[model samples]
Target: MQLPLFPLNLYLLPGGISKLRIFEPRYVRLVKLAMASDDGFGLCMEVNDNICHFGTRVIITDFDQMPDGFLGITIRAMDKFVINHQWQEEDGLRFAQTSVLPNWTPTEIKYIDRDLSQGLQMLFDEYPEHAAYYPQPDFEDMAWVCQRWLEILPLGTEQKQWFMSRNDHRAALSFLHSIIDEELKDK
Candidate 1:
């Protein structure tokens, strides 16, 4: 499928919601087009002025005119996609030919996954603003938890892309465990 591309230095996986402030004329046009059509836009990572190979296929769930005079839109990721080809329009808006990537299967969060779950809970508790995005989080689903972690973690885009390319959640889960465990050790 083809999608309008919105490049940013952020990662949003399936089931994740993100608020974007659209100020540029090109992205404002992108938002307007997405609102009119059922197909949403592609949120791709822009590194060194280059678009990454992977992106999340997201739809605009909500929109509001912010007090700052920018368009604020809340987008929820529906799926992952691999960008096969992309080009910019005369207005600087980018369009991509993308193929949907399968999401990781939902796995039950076992006892071993508690640390990651609890750490996420702590994050939500500490940041009510962030918590507001997810009124009811799925802490029991390993894939959900790991994807959220992947979004919030300070990992490099290359590392995040590596995790997103995996066929399952095992590798991301193990990596999260190591990262969270190391943080706990420091405390």
Candidate 2:
């Protein structure tokens, strides 16, 4: 499938939610086009002035004109895709030919360590604005919890990309365990 691409510094995985402030004309057009069609656009990372190989296809869940006069839109990521080819339109908006990446099978809550979920919940407690994006957050599903951490953590773009490229959540769960365990030990 060909998807409109929005190359930013953000890493969004499936089931992740993020809010974007749209001001650039190209992205604003992308948003309008996305909202008009069920075929959502691709959210990708721009590395060295180029779009990364992997991205998430996201749908606009809500939108409004903010008080600051910019368009505010909340988006939910649906699936991950790998860019096969890309091109730009006259408006400078970019589009890519992509194929869906396989999703990680859902991991049960019992398999995920309790601290990981608690650490994620703590983040939600501290960042209500980010938390507000998800009215009903899933703390039980291991994949959901791990993806949330991957999105918020200050890990390098390449590192996050490597994690996303994996076929399952085992590596991510282990990584989160080490990080969260170290954080807990520091306290």
Candidate 3:
């Protein structure tokens, strides 16, 4: 399916929330269209001045027009998709033909180990405000939690991209555990 592209430097994981300030004229139009459409728009990553092949289909949840002529909006991540082809129109808006990937059964990870869970728990405990948003450590929700952390954490763009490309929850959970351990150690 052909869809409009909104490329950003940030990563947007599934089930995550992204707030965007839409000041650019093209993006303003994009937001309007997304609000009117059912499928919404694609949020792609820009790597080395090129749009990444994978992106998430996002749904606009909140929108308000600011006095500065920018739109303050929040969007929820819905699904992962791949850009099949891309082209630019004369008006400077990017258009892409995309294909949604079939949802994969997230590999189950054992987060029940008291030691592992405690380590993860401590990490979440450090940020009490974010604790509510943290999912219970389990096989089904672990990947989603890791992906959300990867998106919101102060990680490099390359690392974020790697996490997005990964579909296996077990692998993602393991990677996240290692990264979190390393970060905690450094601090």
Candidate 4:
């Protein structure tokens, strides 16, 4: 299926939220059409001035007119997808045919981990508005916890694509452990 693309240099995982402010006529039209349909638009990252190979399917959860008069919308990423074919539309919105990427299975958080849970809380504490965008954090699911962390980190699209291609998030968890260890040493 051909879907409109919203390109940004950002990593968004399943269960992640993207708050967008749309003022462009094409985007405003895309938002309106997506809101009226069940299947939403394609959200692809712009890598080196081109659309990244990977993307996510987004479902509009909330919408409003911003104080600056722009159309504001919050969308939740549902699944990972890779672009198959793409082209520009007459309206200037790019459209792409994508195939869904394999998803990670949720793993139970076997033990309490402050780095995973408390770190997220600290983030929310510093940026209170973000707490409102997501439903309560999933402290019980290791995959959920790890994916959220990955989304927050500043990594290149290539690095992110590598991580996503892995069989599971055990590698991600190991890397995260090293970061948390260093953080503890600093404290």
lDDT of 2 by residue, 1-187 (tens): 8899999898889999888999999999999899889979999998798888889999999999999999999899998988999999999999999999888888877744987888789989999999998899988889889999899889888897888788788899999888877878998
Candidate 2: C-alpha RMSD to true structure equals: 1.5
Predictions in order: lDDT: 0.91, 0.90, 0.72, 0.82
State candidate 1's TM-score. Answer: 0.95
lDDT of 4 at 151: 91
Worst 10 residues of 4 by lDDT: 109-118
Off by over 4 Å in 4: 112-114
**Candidate 2 residue 35 C-alpha distance from true site, Å:** 1.5
Winner on lDDT between 2 and 3 is: 2
Highest-scoring model, TM-score? 1
Q: Which residue window of length 10 is worst by lDDT in model 3?
A: 132-141
TM-score of each: 0.95, 0.94, 0.80, 0.90
- Candidate 1, 116-158: lDDT as tens digits: 8888899999999998999989998999999998999899989
Candidate 1 differs from the real structure by a C-alpha RMSD in angstroms, to one decimal, of 1.2
Query: Model 3 Cα displacement at 68 (Å)?
Result: 2.6
The residue ranges of model 3 lying beyond 4 angstroms of the native Cα positions read: 103-140, 183-187
Clash count, one per candidate: 0, 0, 0, 0
Candidate 3, 37-150: lDDT as tens digits: 888899998978798878888889888988897789988888788888999877678989988864435444454423344555676678766555434444245555566556
The whole-model C-alpha lDDT of candidate 1 against the native structure comes to 0.91
* Candidate that scores best on lDDT: 1
